[model samples]
Target: MRPEHLKVLIVDSDANVRELITGWLKADGFHAAAESSGEAAMRRLREEHTDCILAAINLPDMDILELLRQAKLLDPAIEVIMLTSNVADASTVQAMRLGAFDYIVPPLQRESVGLAALKFVKYRNLIDENANLKSGLEAYRKDGDILGRSPTFEQIRHLIADAAATDIPVLITGENGCGKERVARAIHAASSRCSLPMVMVSCSAIPEHRAERELFGSECGAPDGVPYPKRGRLEIAFGGTLFLDHVSALPARIQGELVQALQRQMFRRVGGTLELPVDCRIIAADSADLAALVRTGEFREDLYLLLGAVQIHIPPLRDRREDILLTAEYFLRRICAAMNKNIVDFSEPARQLMQQYHWPGNVRELENAVERAVVVTVSTYIQPMDLPPLQTDPATLPASLSLEELEKRHLLKVLPLMKWNIKKAAEVLGVERTTLYNKIRRYGITRPLRRPSGSVQVPQQ
Candidate 1:
């Protein structure tokens, strides 16, 4: 917002007026350049950044209104203040409509002009800062998109690029928080369809009765007295990408219909006569095994074959332990910036603990942990105490331990530490609310009775 950092363009056909205004601006600490005609001023504008334009009502080469239009088109952020002797004329109204920042009369007051210029300087600085922040955010998102340099992670990137190179239907399978949707977006961004829409459909969130209507549009009045014609997600995503999340959860009827649509590259709207052609590339994701579901007759085999043309699996964090600290640092920077915290880095013990722990919830859990630590920590660095307790892997337990016993023990340990909050416990356990609820019922996990304050013991686990 400093005046010396701001550049002002003085445009006037009169030599005396141009020199006077330029001198006034420069004396006020702004970088000023004067041009006698509108054309010369526009040429200067194209070559460099101009924070404000002081244009006369009339120019020898072109009209002042035309110059203002061109300057605004070139950079709308640049402020334009009109200078005219006939301040009460209708032309002044036209100039204001054309996006003039302000109007100054013949008796140019230095104080008024300086104050206006200073306000515009502050406005320009804010615009520049917002633009820079947006650019920085975009770079950060792309840089931290898939954070791992491990061999498996590198292979995943190659597969993503290969998938992006073509329009083949993609099937991304991984655990809950392993970033299936992020991979889908990366493919869409890199593909030829980057300019088009990429619509996401959560298959598990829709009800069985409404699934058909949501994917395929319904008629205005064929089935009932409908108000208007509605476009479905498929139609909306034409010439782009359709991302189906938790595809395995799709109903059997919809699965069969979807397979037919995929094969024919077209589908008819529900209660409508028109056959809408499908122009979108399909990408499906699920944590469960689709082949296993097909074997159990829970999913359609044909749809599975159509979607699994090019399958990509995202490995869990435990399998790529070397990338733990790198990914953690990425999240740390992002969280600290968002929280406006000055925490520089994680303590050595915290870093060691993060590397040693198996992140069952994957990147999502790591993000949540870093955000929580940033919000809670008072010191300059994060410590192990700021993080949630590491969960014990059920797979790593002794072979003699029963599955029921392992579930009961994990529930008992995590529930107490989470203060018996089902939502938080579910996040730590990396399971859904219903899934956690079922486990709690099966294992008979419950909160212990409250004790007197003097004798209460907190569970360390």
Candidate 2:
């Protein structure tokens, strides 16, 4: 907030007023420039990157409102303080609404001038500091531990940077276990609100009856002995971030209410009359197609539009097979350190098997596999037997195998792993139970029968 870091522009028709302000600014160690008319002020604004402007509202050659408008268009960051002799009420209000930094009256006090300048200088410094931090983050991300070498991942990294620079709501879409929440965290970490709390809510996990209460707090009952006030995620995420995972699963009633709240950036508690301001940035994530849901009337179109101001889609691990071993090694190191093991790396056979396998569960599955291997490894290097069995050999597969056949085969693998519990199987497959059931019907997959001899057999279709 040093004065030497600022460039102040002074505009007034009166030489005395201009000199008076210029002298004060110079004495405070700020670089100052004086202009006698609005025309000259406009010219200076266009040519220089002035941080602040102090202008007389009664400029003889040009309208003060027009000058303010033009100054803003030139540089939206320039803070303008209007000084007017005439006590016109409407013009003052209009100027304030037009983004003037401050309005001052006659007999400008030294303390007032100095204090106003200090406020704006501090604001400028904050802006510069955030820019510097974001720049450093962009550099670190290039070599950071997020773990990817594919072009899709590189584009996603750049998208994270662009989305973090603004306060816009972001909608992240991808298959489950593809790191949607991690991308949301990256946005928040690279933003100005990095130090603030990031409140996360799983839309699909919240019970329908309590959704409203969980999102917007309830007021305390005076004589009912019920808890009077309870803060919701909206209130808790103020001045920070709110991450809505599985947003497409939000109940219909809440979707409508959320649209209104998101539109105005404010909301009322479940039973309160007051409208509370929402100061948090919202980032929503879903594995399903939200647009398709909108077309089917399951999701509100208006809310989707608001949340999708910036959309980021993460590619599933199978699509980025090049990163399989890279990520596997990354997880291997961390898991080994945590488990206090001396495991250094995976053997060539294990590495080959992992690369050959199709990671239906994406990144989360890979991490779990590596953690499992680390727990059982008895030597410095992990062997193929330490990992889970590979799904199938690509060379052994029938040449006519279609995408649908492959999907059916994977679902069959997942169902048995979940012990034929449809709910758990659905979760592991990243699909709704109904969707999983439909796929089972289409593929004619059935649970295997258990024999008294402790053996299982798949029934004939």
Candidate 3:
């Protein structure tokens, strides 16, 4: 927004007019430059970053109208203000029709010309900022695209299409961090109400004391930060979807109240006694087993039946081992683009190890791991040493190995990854070189030497 940070271009066939405009811009603290003909001005535009261009109606080499068209083609953000001697000139209307931002009469005072240029520059910056925000939002929506080629994932996609065709209440069940919210969003985006907003209510995040007032509307003394009557999230999501995350965590009394309102398709405010219509579709998500809770008398059976009319379950990552490498590669590409890195892919061993490890935390853990690897990796490819030390499940290993034997086995696997580089291995282990040397001596660790006869020898580290 500072004047000195902006560059302005003044294009005029007459030397005197160019001097006047240049002096006006310079006096206003702008970094101003001048060009004699429209052709020269277009050349300068190509070589530098110009914020605004002031072009004369009469040009020596090119028509002013032609220059305006080319300037917009080159960069539409550059504000073009036409310089004319007559306010009623035919070219004035033509320039305005051709996307001229403003018209400046020749021989104007310094203040007039400077203020006009500054105003247009600030406006252009705001437009650019708004465009960037929209672009980022669009990218975010697309990045969460459902991404798996497994048969179960294919079934989920088909179920989503069926859910979108109607307004039936849906229940999404999954382990923690298994993309339940993502599935909910896909349902909303594909439904007829895709143009409407989708509001989410985190049932577990809201306190039990304030749950009722947050779901239904409240008069004056509402807990959601308003001194006057407040419309709850359910009302705000009128024609769209109301997503209930952790639905099983709602208090018992609130759950009962929700049942009556949902069945009758109406609700009332917390303090007031007037009935209001319920127009939003419901989509609930829970990581717990709601059916088991209902059987144990912990969850209401009627509420479960209403919410679980169309149940969709997401399997954990360990159950879908075939999709691990594909999903990891997807996360790698997205994370590298966000971090502005050119990391190509993972080493073959890293890929195998990632797929082999039991991902108890599911997709959330995978995304975090890929992001950490991208941060620490120095080369174009991610090496296994760059990844965090994975906690392997004991059941996957030999049953009789002691703690010392397991540690020694891990050291042997990690040393070969970095090619027996002591300092690199120590860095990955979060220990000093002296400690690594002591461990190597204590465990008698060595690198295997390859021989021409297809045999191997052990060389002590």
Ranking by TM-score: 1, 2, 3
Better of 1 and 2 by TM-score: 1
Instruction: Name the best candidate (by lDDT).
Output: 2
Q: lDDT tens digits, residues 415-452, model 1?
A: 88777777887776666666687777666555555765
lDDT of each: 0.83, 0.84, 0.82
CA shift of 238, model 3, Å: 2.2
Predicted candidate 2 versus true structure: per-residue lDDT over 150-208, tens digit per residue: 99998988989899899999999999877787888888888888768789999877878
After aligning candidate 3 to the native by TM-score, how far in Å is the CA of 379 from where it should be? 2.5
Model 3 over residues 14-83: C-alpha lDDT tens digits? 8987898888888888899999988789899999999888888888887778888899999987878887
On a 0 to 100 scale, what is the lDDT of residue 367 in model 3?
72
lDDT score for residue 217 of model 1: 72
Better of 1 and 2 by lDDT: 2
On a 0 to 100 scale, what is the lDDT of residue 8 in model 2? 95
